[model samples]
Target: MRGLLTVCSAVLVTVLTVAGPVPAAKAAEPGGGDIGEALRHVPGLTVVDEAPAPDGYRFFRLTFTQPADHRDPDAGTFEQRFTLLHKDFSAPTVAYTSGYNVSAAPNRSEPTRIVGGNQLSMEYRYFTPSRPRQENWADQLTIWQAAADEHRAVQAFRALYPGKWLATGGSKGGMTATYFRRFFPHDVDGTIPYVAPNDVIDEIDSYNRFLSRVGDDPGCRTALKAIQRDTLKRRDEFGGLATADAAKKGYTFTTVGSLDKSLEIAVIDAYFAFWQYQKQSDCATVPKAGAPAAEVYAWFEKVESLTTYADQALAPYVPYYYQAAVQLGSPEAYDGYLRDLLRYPGADVPESFVPKSIERPPFDHFAMPDIDFWVRTQGRRLLFVYGSNDPWGAEPFRLGPGSRDSYRYFVPGGNHGANVAQLPPDEAAAATATIRRWAGLPPAGPEVTARSAPAGFPDFDADPIMTARPRL
Candidate 1:
């Protein structure tokens, strides 16, 4: 029990608070260790499987899902054709990746719908690429590492149809989508990476900065303090996701990962440097006396340029990747592990400066390009979706190729996964129209709203009703 708590805690710093008292979780479903069986192809789409081919060439196969399917009145699991098949793309298929997190192993990325005479939920479960892993361990699991296991799935899809267009993933999946298209454009017709953070390095470091600003800047600090106080005071009213539900269900999120409010607050001390670098000193307020104003300002600007996407997104996700060091390690020990990550190789930052990207060296192991890099490189069509209320959605795309992310969609009140899932039926259907058109399929209805600019802080940069332009 102690070891179990330790593992869950490492996976989610606040999991301890949410570790709810509930029914025990069942063991994960079994599989052939072939993810290809999960991605089901459209019923009518002519499918194929691995046939004798060139020795060095990969072939895709068509597969089916018996568990991941479910029935619904609005949308039957197998009733409609939403391209939820396991097809190797003669052209490319959606990568459906996860985000920058510890996805090392014992993970489930796919969602199953209970459909016609089918088993319960089906998922794309993950395994630890490393050995000596823990039972119910949450560390060392990363979406990037999932690459080691994706070959069969990709090959299977490719063999199913050799020359189909592609639509890979969302968030982490988006990264894969962008990568596949950028690096292997000829493999698939094009890609739709979705909301994947291409600048993974920037996402993590930038988030740390964002959090620091929430604590450091007077206005942001005021907001944080106010939120903390309010949540604490009402406590019960806010639903206390961590303490109540997570704790009750034992769903993980209980671990504090070498931090409580106090420790997290302290960690934010160093995080300021990262933020200043990523935000280009926008996060800077009046400097303290230890560093001169000019020196501090100059130092920050240098950091900002390198505080690219990869730095921010991946840095925070690294510590958790080392499960033993995080879930089971002492708070002080975990804190040090985090510190060690800041010193990755080719890390160009000054001793006093932390690299704004991930604490690890950039691992383009797959040799894939990021979001915008693919857009510019392959001239791909995309449909970006995100929520306004999502804390992760706060950072509007900009600075690098992201400023142009506005070219996609900026949804209002959308948070993380909520953006796409929450779309009104008509609206979502329209977006699908845009995708089909991009995929070279005949449009089934009025073109879906390909790009939208909802009203918000940056305040609708341009009109949202415009149709997507054919590759210009």
Candidate 2:
């Protein structure tokens, strides 16, 4: 396994120097204009509000109307909400693309915090207010269309924030950032995708291997698998507990068809979720052998709740599932170990989880192959972060030794939330030094501070609303 040194500071700097010449910046277009003047004439763009932000900064909330399907621009459009955190027109800019609903409020991204530059946070298409009034799942939810949407935003903003621009996001958002770069190579100067995966199969086999051995101790692994087996063996008793709990929480699993199926899926998801979010220390919470069925179920609930698969929890993410079924493949449940105990052995099938209202188009298996080739061969000025134990890290982009101006960093024993900031001081210094040099800034120090997150910011790791297990 590649260790933390792969992304350590010195290695990154060396890669940058040895990699081919940094791509030259595109020539600035004629008629340079301010942000407000630039937006006034752009089609489908309107600056709705501007207000003071933290750290003496200011921001603007804008709505961008983009075609539902980029291939057919005249077909229809949807309003994608975005926020612009202003520093200076001449300062570096970070384009933060989110993979889910764009929060109505303003926020700062990790890149912006490190670079101390302006930020543009764009919401993903077909999510929340970004969704078209008339939903068209067939042609509208493809990653290509979403990338085109971000391309438009970058094009519009380039005329305003004429300085350096970088793109970034976390998890699915991180995946979106890389897709944006792949589809629109010249849209931004660089990209930093955190905990992103390039899933190549409908049922990613790597996750199964990852779950087989994650924590430091073998007993913890044995205990976790035993708990899963016990839960499935006593699913009837556990199902009743789950059903009553779902009622109290007002969650329904109609998307999966029945409460029993929901409970089974929850049990299947627990093993993955445990390692995905929890630290090695958390393995102590796994129930021991012969633990009461209710206690085992409660531990399951604590680690991965049945409510995660509820109708309301899954409603906003229907578009994601559609994309997964079509082009963005998802991980299949690792049920091989517990196959004997599972009542519905096929519950982990990708299509089985998708809602009936949405059609599952034929997956273009070649899509990921093409993307992988592009990212591995031609990708430049890109940095990747992944946790050593993150199951999704199993399929990270393979950055060859000969690859240039690109680097991948693995947090030793880190989970999905790993990043440069979370690295040890020496490693963080090394990684940030590379980022600072890339962003055309001076050496890093106390001057860089992350802006406060908006109120009610959803915790992606633990919050059920934000937890959608992507195979990637």
Candidate 3:
């Protein structure tokens, strides 16, 4: 998924309780039939705290105790954190499956907003706030295990929210939702994976192919390369500038070797960022090879952060790199054109970024391929949204003959931020109608103004899964 930092940032609307008169206090116990008590009743579930929610919605921060290794109940247990946005008991429930950590704040997903239903926004297992006690990254963080964690959470919550259920997520979360549906076919009535990729391996070259022919303007592609070549041509100058800048900021680069190597990787990533996040209009800002040193350096930083490949920035995402190197395939760097200008040629592979402390087993080459095959053929009620221009959209999940009630829609010029609401009116209507129908809602969905990420969490650079590979 593109932006890991873009968690739901709806201003915490502080309130006393669920949007209703407080019921007489009965002993907080299961089977009491009260929704609040129903939440307390689910086995392995604990109420962490209540958070401010959108008006008419009650938000509860929750933790569900899950086995470290689902196959062995006796192995160990970890408390996986999640949030419940309650609207009504009879309303449909949207399982907002997260590909990474669940934010403490309550935010509405497109589906949840449009459907006006309850939401179960869950943090993926092995992520922050949900990690196991003993570090068993290699054995405990499989795709199947994460799906199992979601399944267990969903099963427990289904008891309280007996209405229809729909699963949805964007970027990596979208992939998580897909895996959830793949493993537990009937867990949710339908799934919408927005701008998710189905890369077949740890290091795929599809991105290189996509970037070569990405935008409508041939000039924009040429301009992107021009800036990359310009940055490297002045590596000595920019490298010194970056080094001093890093020192001033107190940034460290031990994780990715040295500041110079991080600079090289950041230069390579600028091209990916241009297409992954920037639009055609932004191409006007591309600096020429002969542009002033400050002008060129600033442009590079603007397109892609200089600290992107640094150890300090990468510490939060080591788990993502481990997963990518181990199972979830990731896009390799678009470094073919920059190889001649590159000082560190092979630093862009997925494995380079993983920490040395965590042991990575050989990539389970079949895991993702099997998932791709299953989602293509037998997956049902699956709706996929992609930005036509987003590089991650390059390896989108394809619907096959055996797939039933499935759809894949692309927002014409959408990037990683693409969504059903962004699709053309007809396409958006069709996609929303399908989701509404599957979730047992009325044919006409409500008008929802698209919500942006809360300030400080930009979707493009903050992506958790496919951030630029670190230099080794």
TM-score of each: 0.39, 0.86, 0.87
- Model 2 RMSD in Å is 7.4
Compose the digit string of candidate 2's lDDT tens values, residues 353-380. 6789777768876566555666766687
Alpha-carbon RMSD to native, per candidate? 18.7, 7.4, 8.9
The residue-by-residue lDDT of candidate 1 on 1-472, one tens digit each, is 3354334324432322221112221222232223333333322222234333223222333322111111112221111111133322232244343322222121111111000001010112221112222222232233322332232233334434443344344444455444444333444443444444333233133443434333224654443233233332332332332234334443322122211221222222233233221232233442333443344334322422111212222234333333212211111111222333232222221211222232333332221223233354334454555444333433432223423222345444343343433466666665555655555555454322322321211111121111011000
Query: What is the C-alpha lDDT profile of model 3 across 249-327, one tens digit per residue?
Result: 7888887788888888888888877777777788899987788988887887767876677777787677778888888
Better candidate number, 2 or 3, judged by TM-score: 3
lDDT of each: 0.31, 0.72, 0.75
Give one clash count per candidate, in the order shown.
95, 0, 6
Query: On a 0 to 100 scale, what is the lDDT of residue 397 in model 3?
Result: 90
- 376: Cα error in model 2, Å: 1.5
Candidate 2: stretches off by over 4 Å: 1-42, 201-204, 290-298, 446-472
